[model samples]
Target: MTKELETKGAAIQGADAGKYELSEEQKAHQQERILKQVAKELQLPLTKVKASVSLLDEGNTIPFIARYRKEMTGELDETQLRDIEERLQYLRNLEDRKLEVIRLIDEQGKLTDELRVAIEQAVKLQEVEDLYRPYRQKRKTRASVAKERGLEPLAIWIMTQPRQGSLEQEAAKYMDEDKQVHTSEDAVQGAMDIIAENLADDAKIRAWVRKYTQDQGIIATEAKDSEQESVYEMYYSYQEPVRKLPPHRTLAINRGEREEVLKVRLEVPAERIHDYIAKQIVKGESIVKSTLLLVIEDAYKRLIAPSIEREVRGELTEKAEEHAIRIFAENLRNLLLQAPIKGQVVLGVDPAFRTGCKLAIVDETGKMLYIDVVYPTPPNNKVAEAEAKVKAAIEKYGVQLIVIGNGTASRETEQFIADLIAKLKGRGLRYLIVNEAGASVYSASKLAQEEFPKLDVAERSAISIARRLQDPLAELVKIEPKAIGVGQYQHDVAQKHLDESLKAVVESAVNHVGVDLNTASPSLLSYVSGINGTIAKNIVKYREENGKFKDRKQLQKVPRLGAKTFEQCVGFMRISEGVSPLDNTPIHPESYEVVDRLFRELRLELDQLGSKGLKDKLQHADAEALATKLNVGVPTLRDILDSLQKPGRDPREELPLPIFRTDVLQIEDLTPGMQLQGTVRNVIDFGAFVDIGIKNDGLVHISQLSDTFVKHPMDVVSVGDTVTAWVLNVDLKKGRVGLTMKNPNKKQ
Candidate 1:
């Protein structure tokens, strides 16, 4: 080695004397290059990918774009959009570290052309370390001590194989007593150890090992022999390759290791690894090749092996988390998109005993009509009075359906309604047990209090129950989805992640079912496109001050609701008396000109296009002719025509009626294997929860949801879906109701 090289290496070990920094511009350039490569890998348009990155950098939520900005994103779904967002964050972080590594090497005056090229091409931190391995500082090991003792020349001679004598004969020259040079064998062995340690710590060797292990590593765990009946029992005899292991199994194994219930180790086939490392070391038969081989073996044993094991395990765990989160987000979306049961005159009952059942009636629009109290269950002993009160309310309010809250004494209240129905032999009267998980929370909320100041807290709860049945999307938005009690281990997951995911579900559902601009509450309006809480409140206040909105143009008159907000949200906000009928449909105002031209081409007025016969004729019309005339697609033409036919049709009206039972009050009344009609309240990764007219919600675990294996519960049932479930087990003390959907014939 040269004297200059020695000095630079010393400076690197001492620090302060050698350190460099890159400019911000240099870092940004590197980031841009990396992003371009990622875009290529994903096969996304560069402009679109960059736009998504820019949005993420500014902390814009994904749900906002997926629902409102169809034109800007080319209508990317939530999954594709989120993938881009996650990748951008990772690439940015990698670029930052690259800049730091470059500066450190330049300061040490050790930045060679080869090193620079390696660092520039490195895509991960492990790759960067591999390039830096030869330059890093080291302690006074046997290799450095040998070099100091003047034995390095002999070692180098052997490594080079430069037409010399045998290795021992060559080493004799450096074996002077004054230098404390030992036997040729001892000197050569010490030299080999130094080389081995150096190779082991080399960044290149570590990176290679990591890649190999990630592809071939097997994670095995054995129980400690003490906790056989513990949480880790399933994983006690587990051994599986990292890549092949299922996500749930990975999480279970990791949790077991965290609790110290299992001893875990990652293993790879030895012969294959040894052969691969040998080839890298012995590229050709030079004297250095022999030393490099020893180094490779030493590195694997001492440094590379252990580090690679941990990295492989960590990567596996991260993959598991990503998979689990994706499943959860999907299920949440389906649950939120569940069809709402609209336009029903509902009688909401918040069932109780000592406090008596609180009943409130709501009209088809979810506005509270009347409030009353009745002791339907024990202690009051007023069954006849309760029956009379219910009948009178139903008759007076012209209630079509009864919505009983799924809370305390719910089944008893359901039975009371059943008896009242039989006594009156009423027509068009059906009672539903609503999933009232978060009703109590909503009743005591500040928003509820502000909306109904004159009514008691119990009465507000009844109103919430009625509103849920009338428009689930609007009312459910007031409470947190996790608190709505539909998910599994919701509390155990990351709170911010869960909240953001669930919020996206709610927003998507709200937009899917267009809101009534005239009658929607501020809370419901807030979820609409371009309308925030402040704007929603302003809209409601303006409507109250003035009259109902007669057209989309009136939205701009609301305070703080500008033209841009109106443009984005107006199409989603339906007006029955709008000047342009298209405003009531999901078709954007930007497409109104095209729609009007189509109407003119058909030789029909806009009003004449509202019938199914006219729509069918328009849909069958040639797309090529329309494209030639209006410069639009057959698809776009058809879409526009359909929107015109049924302007402001409530998509919720197409869904099945929510079935609620007026019998089977308690767990004691439920028998194992008994089939019952129930409504699915929430869906999670593990299972779906069904409200079977009982205070306790029944769990339909994913395994029981289908005869075949179900990866997720949402695949079977969604929120607000009426399903038939069989009672598997009923534990009243624990308040557990286990239900199953495994049998197709199980439903009543």
Candidate 2:
């Protein structure tokens, strides 16, 4: 390692001590590379990718840029923008790591022109690491010891595979007692160690070996204790090819292994790997070929095999985690965007046993009208007494719908409510069971406490249940998106990735539905395009100190809300009684002038928006020609038209309402081929879990999702989807039910 070998790159690295600071020109070059690569991979135009990247770099939020900058991004949606954002971040990180790795290699006097170019041109971080492996500084190892004993030259000489060399004499030349080389055999072994490490660290060799192992390996699992029964009994003696293993099974096997209930192994094709290594390291019948063959075997067994197995396993886990995060994100988006049962007075029941069921009545606007507790199950089954209080509250609060929390004692409470509604006969009342997955988490949250300090946890939960029936997105936003429990293997996946994906899903949904600025809580407001938690709280504080915001422009007066924040968030904040009706619409303030001009061009009053006259004109308006006349792009003009047509509209309202039931069913009552309607509570990679008025949600396996082959469960169904499913089987003792979405009577 000579200091004089240091070059210009090394000098720069030394100046900053490996700070990874790229100059302006370097950053620009890197960004251009990243944008071009993202565009190619995503199949988007390079110009569009560049425009979107520039917007993102300028601090424009994904939701804002997606909704408002369609002209610039060629109509890219939120999903595309987020994909671009993720790619840019990963490539930037890769570029930074490459610079750092290059500096480290150059400092060690090992950086060559080919290696430097390889590192710079690498697209993935793993590739950079692989290229740097041979030059990387090492801890104590057999190879390091061999190098210390001056055996590297002999190793290199043997690698040349000389046709006429004396193996014994060559090995004897390295015999020295001072540095642990005492005999010809010891010298031979030291040279073999050096050669083995060299082969193992070669980038191309490792890459080829890793791919071969991953393609041909089989994942095998067996019981750690065979006699112990477990949910993973099917995996007791299971083996599946790595290429054929599904993501959900991967997560399940990983979890079982983690819990020590199963022993797992990767059964790789050892003979093929050995042959390939021999082919690479050995030539036709050289003098050192026999000794080098032994070196290959030792290297693979001691170094390469284990490393390749771990890399394949890590790759499997990373892919599985990514798949799980995607599933969770899609499910969460659908769950959060479930159609709200608006304009209905709701009675919420939080069922329990000895502690009693908590009841809360909310008006059509989601304001709490009443709250109390009644025991209708088990130890404190106050059937008639509970019915009277519920009936009286229904009458006093004009409750039209009842929402029961699907939690402890839910079935018993549901039966009680069914009987009570039966006694009422034609009272125009109905009850629906709602998934209360995060009600407990929300009840104990600080936001819940601040909203209802005088109420107990269960009471707060009841209110949440009632309010969610009114507006799922608004009420559910108060809880963490992951806690909503719409995901499969959420706890087993990479937590940071899942959290980031779910956060983006929530933000996308919140902006899509548009929040009522005057009424949205800090949680919902924080998810709006540019608002953070602090700004959200400040907006609320400002509202409380002054009053309901009567105009959109008043948002500028709030502390910490500047021009950028206002620009990003204002379009998604709606006010029902704002100074301008456009404030209640999604129309951005910047487009107000064009809209007024549009109204003038149509010869319609501003109040005529959403009226028949505006609809008639919009139906006849030529978007392309009108946009040219209006000096605006067609996409922007079309968006303006859509927003004007549906002022203060919720995108969720267009979806089918959740299935409401006035009765309950038990697992014992489910019979094979018996058809029933249900709502999909969660979708996983394997299938969808449907709520069919039973204690446990029925599982519709992937095979039964459709008659045709289904690629994934999400392609067939999502969270909050309504479908007709037939009961396939029921395990009475285990309280499990299986369902099929295929019709039994349909002919093949």
Candidate 3:
């Protein structure tokens, strides 16, 4: 399997060259295979897969189909829709290739009924290639040269396994000086070469060997330079069964090998493979048995082993990369959806030392109210002066939250802010450390500069910090998704695959929360369903020139946003202060007739959509019968009912609120078994990094994630999760703290 994953970590293998070559009739047949494979793999209904695939092929975006066309897909969510799309592409490519290969083989006059059946039934690209191995065009190997010398007949004759004939003497009949067969020995050797190559190309044997290798192989590594002082020291003398190696370890070994820090190889029981091949090809005892035995040894060691090893290694790396990218995508989605500390004036501080901490104060609406710099840390150590400036801004803007970036000198700045806030203890102010992973990158980005042309990089970062506290999804969209640094070995994975998955995650989050049509930035608008970057820019321009949008229909007037784009994106774009209250809800324009009917038939008015009277009526309504009566899908009607209850609701509010701090704690304050609350900063395959009001985040290893069996850290925690963890170990020298989520009070 090629295992080329992109969005949603597609397990789509093979180059889809045949997708363009397939005829409509061929594609129609391929559709059945695709649907069945997808349904079986995802355990979704086959009918649902067919409908989802049809919607996808008609150019509908995933978020659009997931939200608006729920009935057609049996209420499959975005994730299920994307998976069907992934498998559909893979199976279509597989079918198209099967047809293309059949055409290629038939054109060469080698097609047969058995071969056709084998090709058609092949489930994976690897199987198809194996079946096509012998017929595939060759690069002048020993077999090809043997055919040139008329030794193929001799090789074919040897296959009958003459019970009592001298193999070399039988070969002597074909010896000719013109063909370079100087002796019977030379002719026999050439015949054996042909037999060896043919044995290596046998599809059935190749499949068996591939499976046996993986089941019995050991992946071993050793240091290339013993004294290199590398981070892969643990892998210096490592040995793991190929079947049991985890994704992270596989990626690590690949990186180590790439950096030339280690020499890695797969160790398998070669004798067993040789014996297996001998049994499959040698047949009964005969004069040719000894020669065929030699052929098996040559075919395996010289041809099959090397190629299988490379394929297995590629598969391992691909699987690992897919897992890592998925982790990154999930973490990023959770990070973006982090509950915003809304309705409060926030003071954002981009912590620094010599350059001074940059400060930005944003109001409840995220409008920048003030920007300044302070030098309360190191070098100048102007503590009192910095404190006065911050105090003036806080008192002037009535700031309720102090958001400090966890960067250089962040600990010192937090201490200073803690001291200052403590002095005004009754002001009802709180402070918290914000992850600054992508702040610097976003600050220097072209988008940031365009958004705030007058501000310097650090000053812009301060504003971003403040805005992130106000609304993470809106502010985070300004930066590239992968730059957020949420996963392990992100840089080592396939860059294109990682980019596609992360972008999808961002889109999913943006749509889930819904976008405000009037006040959204161009950066945020670009991720809304069908809106491209160009169309997003056009939207912002139109809004700036014409003022706020009164209705969602006004989006049609924007340049380059045609009817199709509008249809795909309108439901995700909400107008909170629009002329029509229906526009504020997720109810699609096409569903307006249904909503009007729901209200009219239920003896309700549009103004009373979310009122307790209507909500109660909706709560007890027969949704199934009502959906049929309204001529809409039950899922869509339910969604409309939901949207009507709480129009323009920000879904982030439902999640647990972010943890705020009133004081700072140094590493010295942590003790073993001390329970503390913290926010999960980043989650990887093995553990989660949590910010517990300290400089470095503490780690909750998968082992300590729970008292019961725990598989992955993500299963227990995600980024922005508020968890209570007990300190297990604190190493002041290394500035590391180990934590466990298991309650110490629970009896084992």
Candidate 4:
């Protein structure tokens, strides 16, 4: 370490430094050390990481880097690159604080080697205070003002054990009527107050107490009598150990305290803490020890206790917020990955009033087949005509499913479909009520307008409803994920953080399901590996201009799509009838040579190996055969074989189908204790909203989600999940339905 670093370390150790305090220099050096450590962890060359850090500190966005800096970061993915960016910002903030602290200490003219080292090594604000304790300003303190009266020698003599046998006799030598020390008892009492105040402000003692209180404190709160019947009634008599409180309970308690519904207290056993402080300060003397103990007690009661309590509460709140965010992130990942119900011919209905009902027919693959309008509701007064028109279209197009947008006149439209299905009971068909949260937004979108310029906005909405059922991942990706309504306090949370988190969810979902290179829209394709917006457009243009790509090699011809992009993304882009079988599986195209060698060694052709039986054979194949023939590990070869057997099978299909209802029920019709099957529409931190065929959704709070305590609503129910919940409370006036997931008959 340099002299500056050594000096900082000493300051941190609380060693007495000479008149020149080294605080300022130490803090600056400490910041430099943190930056170096962060840069090294990111595995970037020092220069490159430092340059990026400087740019970020000046305020640049992550999207700017992911798009523009291909060569700068060795093309790091968005996630890894953003992690480095966040850490850089944090370190820079720490550096700015260090500079400010150092400047303040230097101005005090108390800079020393030990003080400098302490400032440099300080990891937290608390540590900084402990080091600065000895030098901090004192107000009209008893000890300092007493010293001004020329009582230092007497105070020191008493503290050091006076040479005289009696402290009173020694104290009388310094006492005078002008100094206001008339009696020995009065003089001793005044001296004891000075000692007590000094002991209370001791930096080392305060630091140890702060740490102990944080580890052992319990935040206790009781409801005020006036607010005893409020929403926070349960928390009126609440007291929970800081470390043991669950995330939801912590948030609830804090919210209660903030609203003044509870009187909160942060308590710790102070007796044990006082004993520890006494050991450090009042070493061994009967008279001095008695005075020191009295001083320590006064100091704690007057100052230290209150400060420590506030700090502990702040730390607990921060910890709770962190845990809540982590839970939100996990739930979002699973909700986004819910299965896409594929390959169904659907009749989409966007119900309306003056415009009647806009109907659009889409093929099994989501291609628009036809569009029309029918008045199925009031003002038309011709229900017969509307019914005939819908039946004829369904028959003509062979529509296997009916998707009604949950918007205006949706209940009436749903009734029409249910009646139609009842009349044609022998016809194999199903109907679903699709959430239209962002359907209108998507219809007005530039991308949607470009895809359907000739169709009216109403018809575009119908098409969206149909497509959402066919592939929820692809359709939902067109709109911002936040607009999809699956987060808790999303708007209140950091906007940039929410966007990044949701984007990760979308990307992970898209890749998990895989995509068809030729048929996928550019919006969907952009999420695929190696395929950005420009290249995705190019791939679409190439397909439209020259027909479908016959093999993976043809992808190289797309504008601006290079060899490196192909290597990262080709295996994830599936082709239904490509020239090679591996083109349809997740096994990268580069691994084709290895598969071919394995095939030859087994005396089998690629066509014969496509059978399901071949998967079993490959699963049990010897490790030595794989190693000798393919020059790869058995594990790698086995993974490749498994991918080949499935050949683009979506992982999401393993989940249950989204629930679709035929009849709509109102809040008034729902009674307390009534059980109903509902589909989960969206998940938030506090609860999950279930669509029970009513225009409004019912809420199942985290506590009501299960008999056992749920950390999050998604722990038991996910987006599109069908759950059986009982109505716990129904407020018709407010149009609110409170539900419970736990079975009512089950024993507690």
Count of residue pairs whose backbone atoms collide, per candidate: 9, 0, 0, 19
Candidate 1: where is the Cα deviation over 4 Å? Answer: 1-115, 123-203, 211-241, 252-313, 351-358, 371-392, 407-424, 440-446, 452-459, 557-564, 633-635, 665-748
* Residue-level lDDT tens digits of model 4 in 193-268: 6666566667677788888887788878787785457878877777778777766676777787777788888788
The true-versus-predicted C-alpha distance at residue 294 of model 4, in Å, is 13
Question: Candidate 4: worst 10 consecutive residues by lDDT?
Answer: 1-10
lDDT of 3: 0.88
Candidate 2: residue 41 lDDT (0-100):
88
Error of 1 at 85 (Å): 4.7
Residue-by-residue lDDT tens digits, candidate 1, 689-745: 787777767999888898777766766777767888899988978889999876646
618-654 per-residue lDDT for model 3 (tens digits): 8888889999888878999989888888887888999
- Candidate 2 TM-score, C-alpha based: 0.96
Instruction: Sort all candidates by TM-score, best to worst.
Output: 2, 3, 1, 4
Q: Candidate 1, TM-score vs. the true structure?
A: 0.73
Question: What TM-score against the true fold does each predicted structure earn?
Answer: 0.73, 0.96, 0.93, 0.66
Give the Å error, residue 431, model 3.
1.6
**How does each model score on lDDT?**
0.73, 0.89, 0.88, 0.73
Model 1 alpha-carbon miss at residue 405, Å? 3.5
Angstrom error of the Cα, residue 717, model 3: value is 1.8
Q: How many backbone clashes does candidate 1 have?
A: 9
Q: What is the lDDT of candidate 1?
A: 0.73
